[model samples]
Target chain A: MSNIIRFIIKYNLVFFFLLFEVFSFYLLISYNQHHKETFLKSSGNVTASLLQLSSGFTDYFSLKEANEELSRENAYLRTLLPDNKIDKEIDDIYSIMEDSVEYIYRPAKIINNSVNRLHNYITLNKGERDGINRGDGVISARGVVGVVRYTSQNYSTVLSLLNTQLKISAKLKESNFFGTLEWNGKSYQHAILSEIPAHATVSTGDAVVSSGYSTIFPEGILIGTIQDYELISGEGFYNIRVKLSVDFKNLTYVEAVKKINKKEQLNLENRTLND
Target chain B: MISSLGKYIVNFIIIILAQVLILNNIDFGIYINPFLYLLIILSLPVNISNWLLFTTGFITGLIIDAFTNSIGLHASATVFLCFTRPYILKYFAPRDGYEPGSLPVPSHFGNAWFFKYILIGITAHHFFLFFTEAFTFTDFTTTLSKIVASTIVTSLIIMIAQMFGKRNKRR
Candidate 1:
C-alpha cells in the first residue's frame, strides 16, 4: 500500500495532466453541437463599451459621406412621392380611395466589417432596442448586403453577401429570368448567380434586383448586374457572373429593412408548406 | 512570488486581449491564426514544479477557450505541450546545469536552443489543436496543410514575441 502511495505521489504531475486533458476532451465530445453561451461569446461589456466609444469618435469623421448618402436617398424617394396637388385632385375624384404605398427604412452603422474572409460577418450598431431583429434584410445604396442573423441590445451581426451560406433570390430586370445569387468565397466584388434557365435572353450589363420571394427584403432592391455568363452542356442552369452593386471594401453605413407583416406571411407559408 | 504572480496575471490579460481583438480578426485568406499565449507556458521559472506548470497552462488555455467559443481546443493543446515541456528541456539542456530562477528566453538559452524549444512546443500545441478542431483525418492532405501553415505562422510569432519580451525585460 505504501509503495502504491509513493508511486502515485511520484507521478502526480503526470496524473494531473492526464486528468485535466481527459476532462477537457469529455467537454468537447459531450457538447458536440455548437454550445453558444451568448454571455461569453462576444466581447465583454467593458470592452464593447470602449469599442463603441471609439467608434463614436470615428463616426464623426464620416458625417459628410453619410449625409451625402442620406440626401441621395432622399432625392430618390422624392421622385417616388406623388405631387401633393395631384394627390388632392385624385382624392377628390375618388372619395373612397385608400393609401397603397408605405416605406420604412431603419438606418444602421457598421461597427465592424471584414471583406476578405470566407465566412465574414458584419456587426452593426443597431439591434432589438433599435427595432432590428434576425431575418431583417440589410442593404447599402449600391446593393443588397445580407440578412441579420443574431442580435443584442445594442448590436447586431449581419451575415455578409460574400458568405457562402447566403442565397438571395434575384431576377434580371430586362427579362423575366431569375436565379439565386450566391457568393463563392473568392472575390468580394463578384458572385455567382445560378439556376437561370439556359433559354433566358440574359446579356452583360443586365440589371438584377431582388425577387421579393422572402419577407426579409422588399421587391426590386438592386443586387447587381450580370457581368459574364456560361451555359454548361447538358445542364439546365446558367453559371452567370455578377458585379455586385455595393463596394464591400468601402462599406460604412447600411439600412435595415423591417417588413411589418413578416410574421403573418411566414406563418401562412408555413401552413401551406405543411399542407 | 507575488511579483511573479502579478506579472503572470498581467501577461495573461494582455495576451488574450491581443489575440481576440487583433489576431483573431485577421483573416489572412487561410486560417493561419497565431496563438502566442503559449509564451506564458514557455517562460515559466526553471525550477517550478510540473503540476503547477500544467495547472497554469490549463487555466490560461481555458480562459482563451472561453473567449473564443471553442470548448476544449486551447485547453487540450496547452495541456499536451505543458506535459511535454520537461522532456523537451531535458533533451536540450546545456552541459552545465540550468541556473536557478533563470527564466527560459532566447537570451538565457542560446538562439538555437530557444528556437528548438519554441518550435517543438508550438508545433505540438498546433498539431493537437488543429487536429481536434477539424476532428477528422478524412481530408488528410488539407488537414496537413493547415497544420503546416498554422505551425509556421505560430512559430514566427512566438519567436518575434520572445525577442520583444526579452528586450522589454532588459529595460
Candidate 2:
C-alpha cells in the first residue's frame, strides 16, 4: 500500500495531464457533433455578451455600407410594389390570390461571423425573444445565408453555408433539376452542387436557387450562378461549381425565415413514416 | 507594481479579447488563420508546475473554443501543446537553466530561441488542430497545406509583435 501510494503520488502530474486530455477529447467526440449545442450549453451567454459588446462599437464603421445595402434592397422591394406595375385593366378585379404567406421573416443584425474556418457560424442579435428559433432559415436580400441552429433568450447562432457539414438542396433555375449544394471548405465565395445528372443541360452562368424541398427555406431564393462543371469519371452526376451571391465577409443584416406550418409538416411526415 | 500572476491575468484577458473580437473576424482567407491566442500559453512563467501548465492550456483553449464554437478542437490541440512544452523547454534549456520567474518572450529569451520556441509550439498546435478538423487522412495533403500555412503565419505575427513590443530592460 505504501509503495502504491508513493507511485501514485509520483505519477500524479501524468495522471492530471491524462485526465484533462481525456476530458477534452471526450468533449470533442461527444459534444462536437457539428449540429449540437455543445458550446452553447455552457458559456454561450458569456461569450455572446462579449461579442455583442464589441460589435456595438465596431458596427459604426460599417454603418454607411449597411445603409447602402438597405437602400438597395428597399429600391428592389419598391419595384415589386403593386403601384409600380402598369395600370392594367383589373381582370376579374377579385382574382383569387394564389399562395398565401407561408413564411415569416424577421430581420436580425449579425454580431459575429467568420468565413476562414473549416466550419463557421454566424451569431445574430435576434433570438427566442425576437421569435427566432432553431431550424429557421436565414437569408439576405442578395441570397440564402444559413440556418439558425441554437438560440438563447436574446441571441442565436446560425450554421453558415460555408461550413462543410451543411448540405443545401438547390436547383439549376433554367432546368429545375435539383442537387445537393455544399461548401468545399476551400473558398467562401463558392460552393459545389453534386449529384446533378449529366443528361441535364447545365452551363456556366446558369442561375442556382433554393429548391425549398425542406421546411427550412422557401422555394426560389437565389443562391448563385454556375461557375463551372464537369462529369465525374465513374459517376453519371456532374459536379458543378457555383459562385455564391452572398459575400459572407460583408454580411451585416439578414432575415430569419420561420416556416409557419413546420410542426404540422414534420408531424405529418413522421405519421406517414409510421403508417 | 503588478504581481507576476496579475500580469499573466492581464495578458490573458487582453489576448483573448483581441483574438475573439479582431483576429477571429479577419477574413484572411482559408490558408492564413493565425491563432494569436497561442500567445497566452506561450507567455507563461518558466517555473510554473506541470498541473498549472496543463490546466492553463486546457482552460484557455476551451474559452477560445467557446467563442469560435469549435468546442473541443482547440482544447485538444492546446492540451497536446502543453504536453510538449516542458519537453521543448528542457531540451532547449541553457547551461545555466531558466531563471525562476522569466517568461518565454523575446525580451526574456534571445531572439533566436524565442523564434524557435514559438515556431515549434505553434506548428504543433496548428498541425493537430487542422488535421483533427479535417478528421480524415484522405485530405492529408490539404490539411497539411493548411497546417503549414497557418503555422507560418502565426509564427510570423508573433515575431513581428515581439519586434514592436517595448524591449524589456535586460536583467
Candidate 3:
C-alpha cells in the first residue's frame, strides 16, 4: 500500500494529464453526437441561445445591406402575388386546381452562422413557435441556403448547403439535366454538381436551380450558374462546378418554406413502399 | 506578488473577452483565424507548476469552446499545448536558467528567443486545432495551408501583443 501511494504521488501530474485528456475526448465525442442527432437539445440549445444574445450586438452593423436585400426580395415577391397577371393566366388554364397554396414562406433573421468549418451551420431567430420545423428548406433572397436541422422553442439550427452531409437536388435551367449539388469543403462560393450525364450540354454560364423533386423546395428556385465542367475518360457523368448565387458570408435574413401537405405525402409514399 | 496576481486576473478576463467577442467575429475568409486567446496561456509565469499550467490551459480552452460552439477542439488542443510547453521551455532555456517569478515575455528574454518560443507553441496549438476540427485529411493540402496561414497570423499577433506587454511592464 505504501509503494502504491508513493507511486501515485510521484506520477500524479501524468495521471492528471491523462485524466484531463480523457475528459476532453469524452466532451468531444458527446458534443459531436449531440450535433449529429436529428434534434439537438441541452448544451446545444444553451450555446445557441448564448450566440443569439451576442449576434444581437453584431447584427446591427449589417442592417443597411440586409435592408436592401429585404426590399429587393419584397419587390420580387410583390410581383408574384395572386392578383399578378401571371397567376391569372395560370388560373385561367387550371380552373379545377386549388392546390396552389401548398407552400408557405415565413421570414426569419439569422442570429448566428459559421462558414469556416467543414460542417457549417446557421442559427435563425425563429423556431417551433414560428411554425419552423426540422427538414424544412431555407432560402435567402438570392438563392437556396440550407435545410433546418434542429429547432428549439425560439431558435433553430440550419444544416448549411456547404455541409458535406447535405446533398441538394439541382438542375441546369437550359437542358433540365438534374444533378446533386454538394460542397467540396473548399470555397463557400462554389459547390460541385455531379451525376449529370456526359451528354448534357453544359457551359460555364448555364443556370442551376433547385429541382423541387423533394418536398422541401418549390421547383425552379435559383441555386447558381455553372462555372466549368469536365468529362473524365470512362466516366459516364459530367463534373460541373457551380458559382453559388447566395453570398453565405453576408447571409442574414431568410425564409423558411412550410409545405403543408408534406406529412400526408410522406405517409402516402411510405405506404406505397410497404405495399 | 499580490500586484502580479491582480495583473494576471485582469489579463485573463481581457484576453478571453477579446478573443470571444472581437477576434472570433473577424472572419478573414476561411483560412486565417487568429487565436489570440492562447496568448493567455503563453504569458503565464515561467516557473508555474505543471498541474496549474495544464488546468489553466483546459479552463481557457473550455471558456472559448463554450462561446464558439466548437465543443472540445480548443480544450484538447490547449491541453496538448500545456503538455509540450515544458519541453519547449527546456530547449529555449537561457544559459543561466530562468529567473524566478519572471514572465516568458520578450522583454525578459530578447525578441529573437521569445519569437522562437511563441512560434513553437502557437504552431503546435494551431496544428492540433485545425486538424482536429477537420478530423480528416481527405483534403490534405487545404488543411495544411490553413494551419500554416493561421500559425503565421497568430504568431504575428502574439508577438505584437508581447511587445505591448513589454511596454506595459516597463511602466
lDDT of 2 by residue, A85-176 (tens): 42444333212111233566667888888898888999988899877899999998899999988898888998999998899999999899
Candidate 1 DockQ, CA atoms: 0.38
Better of 1 and 3 by DockQ: 3
Q: True interface contacts reproduced by each model, as a fraction?
A: 0.44, 0.65, 0.38
Q: Mind giving the per-residue lDDT tens digits that candidate 1 earns over B96-130?
A: 87878777787777677888888888888888887
Distance from true location, Cα of B1 in model 2, Å: 10
The TM-scores, chain A only, for the candidates as listed are 0.76, 0.84, 0.78
Q: Judging by lDDT, tell me the better candidate of 2 and 3.
A: 2
Best first by DockQ, ranked: 2, 3, 1
DockQ for all candidate structures vs. native:
0.38, 0.61, 0.42
**CA RMSD of all predictions:** 6.2, 4.9, 5.1
Give the Å shift of residue A132 in candidate 3.
Answer: 2.6
Candidate 2 residue pairs in clash (backbone atoms < 3 Å): none
By summed lDDT, which 10 consecutive residues of candidate 3 chain A come out lowest? A89-98
Best by DockQ: 2
